[model samples]
Structures are given as C-alpha cells and as structure tokens.
Target chain A: MFEAYLTLMVFGVVSVGFAVASLIGAWLLRPRVPDPIKATTYECGVEAVGSTEIKTNFRFYVVALLFVIFDVEALFVIPWAVSAKTMDIGFVVGEMMVFLAVLFAGLMYAWKKGALVWD
Target chain B: MSETNRENVKNSGEDSQGSAQAPVPGVAKPSIPAAAHAKPAAAAARPAAKPAAPAEVLPEPRLNNGRGRLLGSARLWPTEVWPNPWARPSFVRGAYWLAGIVAGVLLLGWSVGEISVWANLAYDWAMNLLRLRQVPELWAQGAWSAVKVVVVFHLVALAPLFLVWWERKISAHMQSRLGPMYVGGFHGWAQTIADGIKLMLKEDVSPRAADAWIHLLAPIVAAAPAVLAFAPVYFGSGLTAADIDIGVLYIFAVSGMTVIGIVMAGWGSGNKFSLLGGLRAGAQLVSYELPRTFSVIPVILLVGSLNLTAINDFQSGYWLGFIPRWFIFYPVMGQIAFVIFLIASVAETNRIPFDIPEAESELVAGFHTEYSGMKFSLFFFAEYAYVFLSSALVATFFLGGGNAPLPFLRIWPSWLWFFAKTGLIAFCFLWFRWTFPRFRVDRLMDFNWKFLLPWSFANIAFGAVYLFL
Candidate 1:
C-alpha cells in the first residue's frame, strides 16, 4: 500500500513531465515570429470587431441539451451490447429488440418534436 | 558550419515540398509527402523508384508533424535532454508506436503463461471459499506478502507508461504515420525513456503568485488515487493487497481524489484560466461520479458482493458449452450495468468528450496551466492513471473483473484472465482517448447529470426488481 502511494507519485511526475517535454520540444521546433498585431486575441479573420470579451452564443445550450440526450442513450445501450455478445443469442436478441424499441420510441419523440433536427 | 551547409541544401531541396505545408487550417494530413496522404491515385502513380537518389536535404523538424509533441510549444524540456533528437527529423514517432505494439505483445504473451499459474491459484482460493475451508495461513500470505506489494505497485505504474505510448501510437496510426519509430529499432519504445530523462532534468518552475504549499501538494494529491485504486484489482488472480469487503467502494472513493488534486492545482495557480479549468474538472468529475457509481450498482446487486477476487471467481467457468465466466456474458441486469458503467466510467475519468476541464483550446492547458517541470508531469500521470484506474474497475465488475472473455480459454486461472481483461479495457480507454475530440463543457456536464444519472437510476430500479423477483 505504501509502495502504491510512491507509484502514484511517480506517475504524477512522469505524465506532467511528458506533457512539459512535448511542449518544450514544440517550442524549440516552432519558429518564433510574434508581432504586436498577432499578439492580441483573435476574432476570426475580422480585426478585433470589439474587445475579446463578448459572450459566446446562447445556442450552446441547445447543443448541450442534445448531447445529454445522446449520451444517456449510449450509456443504456453499451452494456447491453457488451453483455449481449457473451449471453445466449436468443436472450440477448430479445432484450436488444426491447431496448432498441424503447430507444427508438424516445428518438422518434425527439424527432417529432424537432429536437433531433439540427439547423 | 556543417549544420548551416546542411540547412542550405535542405532548404533548397524543400522547394517542391513547400507546397506540402499549404495551410488547411484545422486539418491534419500525413507527412508521407513522397507518397500522398492516403491517396489511391498516388498509390498507383508510383513510378519505378529513381535508382539514384537526389542528394537533397530536408529539415528534420518538418518530418515529425502532429506527433505527441506538445502543440504551440517551445522545447523547454526535450531540448535539455536530446538537443539533437528534438531538433532534427527522426522516425521517433513511428518508433514509439512500434515499441508500444511490441510491449503490448510482450505483456500479452507473458500473461498467457502467467495466467495459467494464476488460474491454479484462483481455483485453490475459490474452492477454499466455496467449501468454507480456511487455509488461514495461505490467505494471510496472499494479502500481506512484501513481494506482492512491490510487484503490484510496479504493475500499476508500468501500465500507464505503456498506456501513454499506446495512446500516441494509436493516435498516430489512426491519423496515419509511424509514431516514435526513430527512438528504437522496431519503434520508439525507448522514446518513453528519453522522455523520462528529459522530465527528470526539467527545472520545476512555480508561478510567482502560486501558493507554494498547495501548488506542490496538488500534484501528489491528484496522483495518489490512481495508484491506490489498483490495490483491490487482481494482478494475476489470488493477488491483491487487501481483498476488503468494500473493494468496489474503494475504487469509487479512491478514484475521486484526482478531482481534489486538480482543484488544488487550479486554485493554487492564482489564474482564472486555471481556476475555470479546475471548476470545470471538479463539476465534470462530480457529475459523472454518481452516474458512474450507479451504473455499476446493478452489477453489484446481481453479483451480491464487492470482493473483486470473488467476483472474478464467479466468472471463471462455463455455464453451458460456450458460456464464459465474465458478467457481461448472458447477464440479466449485468448487461445494462455494463453499458452504463462503461460510458459513465469514461466520463468519470474525464477522458475525451468529458475532458472539457482540460480543454487545451479554450483553457490554455486547463488546471495545470501554470504548472511546469515534474509538477506538471505529476498531473499528466494522474490523468492517465485515472484512465487506467477506472478501466480496471470496469474490468472487475460488469465485465467479470479478470475473467477470460471466452469460456474455452478458461484453461488459465481467473487471476490471469482478470489482468488480461483489465489490460485490454485499459487499451480501449487509450484507444477512445486518441480517437475522440474534447466535448463542449456544458454538453459534457448536462450529459452526465441529465442522461446518465437518470438511466443509471432506472438500471438500479430494474436490477432491484430483477433480484427481488
């Protein structure tokens, strides 16, 4: 158990080390040509249309809601698939059919409600 | 003078290759410029190789594009170690990939023999348990042996080294180009060694405004859980530090420590970027943890025990002619639990799509933003360690901890089977990390709380009903 603590400590140092190493490596390999114009925060291609502090789009909420829907469904489905491969095909198939039916029902509702339709 | 002359020759030779650097912005392509990036036309267009090669030189740095090399970096660490290796083009990336494959193959091969010994031991233990017979001495020897302690620790640390290499290799191969080939003959297996030395020599820099105590302690706190989380996992079988009654609880509870370390680092750094990264990480880990815990609840309910060693024992034999011992196979609630656990576990560990806290693009390297040298490496190791730790947990529970995937392969003992399965799952974690992009923060959080949490709760209800009936 004590050894484990040391091992974890070593892991902590090593991972950070590699990340830092890669960063250092890139810094050296990359050419440095920073200028005053380039140093400021970017606003797409247009010159700083305003200060770099404008809030991001509110549409981000819509994306979040959509991601939640897909993510939850995947969680429900993945174990069924992994375990299905190991079980009797009949039982696995039957459960999958029911599972898919439920999934489809929800998906259909979402589709009808236009939640699935991303513009 | 020689380097300058070489540079001039290389610069001239690169005139044709100059177009190779055409800016596509947000696109990645292979550097097989001599060939084309996965072009079927180029494959057929191959003329008989020019018998005499042109003496044109090319810059070495351009050769290793999109490797595990940190993006937007200046060689602060690598430059100190292999001044030339980092500076010039070398097949280092390809070498690293090959090395990982070789190491994986070696581990796979070693386990094949070792698992048989492990299986024998597991059979002995399970029989003792089943018959209610106690070899009190044997059980004590198994748990408290000094050799076991050291070996398990090495196993935990070594897994991540291979994992990081494997991640780079997997990513490079997926993106197409050899990964870390130059570091060793087969591939850059030695790349990790070079990397290790480089990191060791790096000056541990603390940000001026950073809280010295917490800043230093944060990395240790973050990394500790990853190592401790492995204590309950069977290495071969019949081999764990302490087979406590609360092993599953141990995994969940210990794994949670990583979030604390990250938060510490973020708060200590005294930077908004770091703080935001820490907050995101904290929220992400906490949200997923409940779902991650519940996802596995169905399985524990079915298994009726949290003893990982015992769990693997249950999975060792064939139910019918083809049944394997693992839980994922032919399960009632186990199947549902397996799926929920796998995804939630991935999110819980803060892997891709769930890695918004450390979102490099927006957060500027996230929680460890101001960290450098070994301190930074500690956080990096913890991230991968968490990946391994959670995968280890996933392997133990719904997938039958360490049991072989196939019933026919049960000639080996359960212990060996367990590690093999755990290692494979760990590989999958690495595989997924390399393949996916970071999830948006709000999307990452909402998915865990809204979707995963509800489904896990539903799974819990269903499992309870199934068990009751």
Candidate 2:
C-alpha cells in the first residue's frame, strides 16, 4: 500500500538527479573563459543602470491576497467533490451550495472593493 | 570599430538615464526618487537630476471593450491576418484529404483485432523464458518500479526535444516558411538534437550581481516538479509510475511548485526584467490556478474519485450504443468545463496570448533573461514538459483516456489511444501559440478573475443540476 509512495519518492530523487547530472556533465565538457564584460547583467546591450530591487506595483499584493482566499476555498471543496457521489444528492448539493454561495459573496465583496482589478 | 561600439554603448546609457529622469507620457509617477535610479556603478558618476512629473495618462489597453468598468466580458480583439502563400497550398489540401482517407482505412483495418492481448501474451512469455515467475513479489515490484522510473524520466527529458522541433516547424509553416530544413537532414528532424548538443557545450554565465546559489537551483526547481508530476499520470490500462489515489490533487500540488522555480529564476538573476517576469508569472499562474481547479470539479463529482485511472474507467462506455460517454460529451456542463480548463491550462503553461510573463518584446526572455547554455535549456525542457503534461491532463479529464471512441476502434491498444488523444491536444497548444497575440498584463488578470472564475464557479452549479437529471 505504501510502496506507491516510495515509488514516487524514487521518481523525485531520479528527476532531481537528472538535472544535477546534466549540469555536472555540462560543467565537465564546457570551456570556461571568464570576462568582466560577460559577467554583467543583460540590459539589452546598454549598461544596467540601477539596483534590480525596484518597488513593485501594489496591485500584485491584492491579487495574491485574493488568490489565497479562493485557493483555500477550492481546497476545502475538493474532498466534498470526491465523496459527494455516495452521499444523498439533495443533502450534499444543498450543503455545497451554501458553502459556495458564502464564498461567492466573498468573491463579490473583493470585486466591489476593486481587489481584483489590475492597474 | 571597437571605439565606435563603446561610444554607442556610452551614448545609449546616458540617453536611457536621461529618459529615466524625464517624465514619460502615460507612465504612473514612480514612488522612488530619481537619485535612486542612478545608484548603479556606471550611473553613479553622473550628477543627480530632478524627477519628472506625470505627463499624460497611460493609454488604457483597448481590451476592455470600452466599458467604463474593467469587469466586462472578455472579447477577442481583432487580429491582422496576412496573406500567406504556404498557408493553404494545393498540395496541403490534397495531403489533408489523403491523410483522412488513410486514417479511415487504418481504423477500419484496426477493428479486426486487439493488440493489447498479444502484448500481454508476449510479456508473459518473456517472463516465463527468463524464469522470473519464482522471484519474490517485492523484488519483482522493485524491479518493475525501477523500469518505470527510467522510462518516465526519459519521457520527460526527451518529449521536449521532439516538441520544440514540432512547434518550430508548425510555427514556421503557419508563417509561410520552412523551419530547420537543413540540420541533420529530412526537414531537420534531428534539429532539436543538434541544438541540445550545442546547448550542452555552451558556457553557462551568471550575472555578477546574481544570487549564485539561487541561480544554480532555479532550473532544478523548475524541472524536477515537471518530471515528478508524471508519476501519477496513467499512460495506459495498467501503466503508471506511482498510481497514487489522490492522483489529480498530487499533479496539481507538484506542478504548482514550478512557479516557485520560475520566480527563483527571475529574482536570482538580479535583472529587473527577470524580476518583473518572475513577479508576473507568480501572479498570473496563481490567478489562473483558481479557474483550472474549479473547472475540474464537475468531473471529480461525476467520477467520485481523484484517482486518474478510476476517472478514465468511468468514461469508458458509450451512451445509446454509439456516442462515447466521455466527460466532454456531457451536455452544456462538460463543454463549459472543458473550454475553461483548456483556456486555463494554456495560461498555466505560459504560452501566448497569456505569455505576458515572458513577453519577449516587453520582458526580454522574461524570468530567464539571465540564463544561458545548459541552465537555459533546462527551463525550456521544463516548459515543453509542462506543455505535454497539460495536454495529457486535458485528454484524461475531457477526452476518454485510453478509450476508443467507437466500438470498432477498440482493436488498437489503449496506450496508443491515450497517446493519440494527448498528441491531438498538444497540437492545439502549438496552434494557439501561432494564432493569437499576447494579452496585456492587466486584461490577462481581468480575464481570469472577472470572466473565467465566475464561469467556472457557475459551472459547478450546473454540474450539480446535471448530476441527478
């Protein structure tokens, strides 16, 4: 029963190993010619002219906030979706509808507050 | 010539600094002071200048259909179609008809026998000849698992090589040109192979300002999940790497990790374009994930299992003796789910028109702007691997996975059917890349939250109604 998960672990290890091995192989075969000019950050041939850590737009934060709220809600609903077929249709559907309606109301609230808008 | 190039670079650098200090039309006022922009090593030699004021309102993208509210129904903006000689040549038309006829005849011929039965017999014979029947079950299982790991790893690694070539050829043909016609002969079938070799031999460069540890790890983060996500996928009737019960959930959770890799690539590079691309990807992938997950609720409800094999089995039979009972065939509800899922999947893979994260004209190569050589190729490998993964899931969730559409078509092995459906859907991904223009960043987000999210939620309600009916 647990062996499938072990297989998954093996797959994970092998996959990461493939990446690391490829890098190692490339390091072995590739030539290293270091130049100060080559090490500079690319700004489409112009000299890069500022710190890379500029202030980001505030709208991305709002989107992230909205995503967390809905993603958690979806996660809660998945188990119900899986088990609903065996349960009473009316009871399950009614229960899920109320849950979804409340979340839908939350989504609407976010919409009205302009949290969903990107500049 | 060298002096002229240096003079050009110096002039452009000064010009860019000058523009940075000037109030550009339509750009929102920068919160940072003008002096902050000149903090770089080369730029510090220049004297500080006063900041510019907001000159003009940035022209709002015409994407919102001119409605005052940003939350209107997303519309397909007009596209400029160019006349292309190669688009529909006489030979191409004949080739399509000829291909269709050949497929029809093949399907007809295929109906006479089943290949899986023969495969099973051959497998048993091989095992008997090797005297492996007496082996312990655990050892056998371990060996089989090892074989599966190798096969899946190779599949993840090699699919991209073929897909990249296929996409290039497809896009080239769509634009009235031949792509890679010379490398390794036969319309450059081995073009990707040659490119792979070239990439491996190329020098890996890291920007002087880059976070060396994170830069090195980014490709692994981006790629490993793509390969691991394949563990739960069902390739055929009994072919799977792990066969986990929560297969659907597992794939979603693992593939979500790829975004982190992308963000790492963006941030670790220490380039503004890479950072912006990463941030955009982070937001865009997160936004679309909502709709993608919600769209699959109907199928999960119907199948009552997150296990992919069970879901595939649920869609195996026909309704009314002819029409297949695949989830996509369900009235109204399935179509909505399928369309939403397809759209969201495209966005998830970061292809055009949703490819704002790496919008080449705007963001350079996006988060990967600083990556080079084998490290760069890893990102490409992960991307094309994702393209294959999403298409496979689309086939599994909407189309009947490993199930023949007609009773007569059941003679072909289920794995063949599975791959055939996956390939057809993969072609659509390539087709979409060449067909549509990139979306504006704002409208791209709006399409998800306002449009796709609402529809996907409404779709679940529709699925409930369809359930008892």
Candidate 3:
C-alpha cells in the first residue's frame, strides 16, 4: 500500500519538477523587454476601465453550493456501488433507493425553485 | 514621402477632432503620424497636451484600389498554368492511394508479431547482461521501476506535442485547408516541435496588476493534473505504471484538480474576461463531471471491480462465437452508457460545441488571457493531453483496452489495438471540434443538466435491471 502511494508521490514530484525546469529554461532564453503599455491588462486593446474585484452573480454561489452537496453524495454512492454486488441485494438496493430518492427530491426542489434556470 | 506626410497630417487632424468628441484612448492614439517629429515647433507648442500619444506613432498608408489589385495579382497564379504535383492525371492519384492502403495493411500485419518479438529479445538481452554482474535483487527491482516511471512520464509529456499537431492537421483537412504544411517535411510532422521552440524563446509577459505568484503557479497546477492522470492508464496487458486497485477512482480524483488550476488562472490574471472564463470553466467542469462519473458506474457495476485491468479482463472474450464481449456490446444499457460517457468526455476536455471557457470570440483566449510564452503553452499542452487521456480511457473502458476486435484475428499486439482505438477516438475529437460550432453558455449548461445528467442516471438504473435479469 505504501509503495503504491510512493509511486504516486514520485510521479507527482517528477512532473512538477519538469514544469518548473521548462519554465526556468524558457526564462533563460526569452527576451526581458518590458514596457508600461505592454504590461497593462488587455481589454481588447482599450485601457482597462475599472477594478476586477467586483462581486459575481449569485447564481455562481448557488452552483457552488449545489456542487458541494452533489460531490458529497457521490462519495456516498461510489462505495455502495463498488460493494453492492457482494451484499444482500434486497437490503442494499432498498437502502440505495432511499438515498437516491432523497437526492432526487432535492434536485426536483431546486428545479421547481428556478435555481437551475440559467437566466 | 512628402505627399503621404501631408495626407497623414490631414488624417491625424481629423482623428484628433473625432477624439475630442469621444476621447477614447486606444482609438485616439493610433491616428497620430510619425511626421510630428519633422515639425518640432508643433510638438513643442502642444507639449502640455497628452504626452503619451506620439511616442511610438507611425504613418500607415491606406492602399488605393489599383495598388491593391497590382499587389494581389502579383501573388495570384492560374491553377491550370502552374505545373503542380496535384495537377497530375487521375490515375496517378488513384495509384498513390492504392499504394498507401496496401502499405498500411502490410505494416499492421508486421506490427502484430515482429514488434513484440524484438521487444522481448531486447529485454532478455538486458537480463542476460545483468546476470553477468553481481546486482542485488532489491536494487534490480528498484532500478526497473524507476525506468518505468521515467518512460511513462515521457509518454505523458510528449504525446501532447504530437497530438496537437495531429489535431491541427485533422481540423485543417476537415475544413478543406492545409495546416502547417512547410514546418518539418512530410505533412508538417515537426510543426509542434518548431512551435515548442518558438514558445520557449517568446517573451514571458504578465499584467502589472496581476497576482504574480498565482499567475506563475497556475500553469504548473493545470499541467500537473494531466500528468498525474496518466498513472493508472494501462498501455497494454501487464504494462501499467501503477495498477492500483482503485485505478479508475484515482484517475477521476486527480483530473478534478485541473479545475482548481483554471480557477487560479482566472483569479490571478486581474482581467474581467479571464475571471469570467475561469468561472465558466469551473461551472462547466463541475456540471459535466457528474454525468461523466455516473456514466462510468454502469461499466463498474457490470464488471464488479474498480480496477481498470480487471474491467478489461472481464470484457476480453466474445458473447457469441463472432461478436466480441466488450462492454459496448452489452445491449441497450452499454450503448447508452458509452454514448453518454463519450459526450461527457468531450465536454470535460473542453472541445468545440462545449468550449465555452475559451470561446475566443467572446472572452479573448479565456482564463489564460494574460499568460504568454511557456505559461500559455503549458495550458495548451494540458488541454491536448487531457484529450488524449480521455480518448484513451474511452477506448479502455468501452472498446476493450488492447484487445482485438475478433477472437480469431489476433495478429497484432494488444498495445497496437489500444493505440489504434485511441487514434480513432482522438480523430473523432478533432472531427467534432472542426464540424460543430461552440455552444452558448446557457445552452451548454442546459444540455448537461437536462439531457446528459438524466440519461446517465437512467443508464445506471437500466444496468441494474439488466444485471438482475
């Protein structure tokens, strides 16, 4: 088990190292000319007019909240799905049906409330 | 020169008057002519005016119609008059096509057995040489594993370079145009390499107001997940880097991290367009991931294992004497799941018709708008790499990883079949990209939630019934 994780760790390190090395190599070869006009933010060739630190739409916050809920649901579903074949089919299926029913209700509620509507 | 100078002065004077009405900086700056240097007195008189406009201004002559015709005609040649290779007789093209088909079939047959024989011979030769030395068992095992890691990393890194060029060529052909025709000989094979070199030498520029550390870190984060996702991908039988028990789960967990990198890029760029692009990417990825994950559940339930190799093994033989028993042939449920998985995979990779994150017409290069040089190339590499990875997974799960289509005609190595299937899927990705227009953001979200999500869930329920029956 530890060996498997070590392999993953090594792979991650090597890949990140490769990314850093290539960036450094490019930095060495690239020209370093900087002008104030060039460094300014690009807004289709117009000078940027206002601050970028403004609040976003509330729809995004709702999506983020839904994502957290669904992601945790997936965590519950995967383990059950993996072991579903080994356990008692009637009991396991009943439990999963209940779990999915609750989630389905939540989805339907969101749909009814117009939360899923893009506009 | 004097005539053009006078015309440019007239143009600038008109532009300044127009600017006084609108006062837009970008439009107002470009109309100033370089002839202002000739008249130092005018410049000195207007010294109190905006000093920034005239610093790098140059005169640009608007071409007249006759001059345009002359320049255009100089470059145009009649197709019939030019002695070109494509203008040859019809039979010549027919013979070339016939020759190519014959060569491809012959190569496929040779690749079936000869390549594996040579590879085994090389392995044996290396082992024999090692036996002559006093190497310890643990040391040998450690060294071999290290070699495997390095080889897999190279495949993960370099495959994208070739795939990028391949996508360009495929897209160009689909649109009836030539792409990168002159870079490195036959069909611009070395075009990506040339592009890599050029990107390396390009100036790395960042916005003055951008978050410096996150701007630099975003590409690394974007690219790292792609590399990590390659860990559990089985190239062939007994040929995976790490055949962990939960291989499929590992792939999903790691690939999800790429969204964070994209979000970082958006937040760090200090551009509103970048921020919008990044948020779109995050939302799109999250929405599509549900269907993608659910689509895989049917396959998992059928195979009763989360291990990718086990899943491949379960789909090894045929159902009937003639038909292969791949999951894709599992009747109604399998076909529906495969379609859902494929569509979700395309969305996950951000290909056309689903590419709202980097919709060039709207967002101007999207989240990576402020990146240049190597940083931008890293994003490009990650995107193509994900395309390749997803295509490979599609082939592995549905098309039978490294397995021959028919049982009796197993001439080629399994890895060759794996690659051929992956290439077919990758070509389909390019086909979709070129054939379809991008989706509107609302429609893109609607398609995922309304259609794909419900269908994926239905597939799982259908699979359960099929299994019990």
Best model number under lDDT: 2
Quote the positional error of residue B173 for candidate 3 in Å: 1.5
- Residue A62 shift from truth in candidate 1, angstroms: 21
Residue-wise lDDT of candidate 2 within B378-438, one digit each (tens)? Answer: 8999989999999999999999998999988787767778888898999999999999989
Interface RMSD list for the candidates = 10.6, 1.0, 1.5
lDDT of 1 by residue, B112-181 (tens): 6654466457656765674575557544444434344556667766776777777877778888655776
**Better by DockQ, candidate 2 or 1:** 2
Give the CA lDDT, 0 to 100, for residue A33 in model 3.
92
Fnat for each predicted structure, in order: 0.00, 0.73, 0.52
Give the Å shift of residue B451 in candidate 1: 0.6
**Model 3 misplaced stretches (Cα beyond 4 Å):** A1-4, B1-77, B80-139
- In candidate 1, how many Å is residue B51 off? 28
lDDT of each: 0.62, 0.85, 0.79
Clashes of each: 50, 0, 1
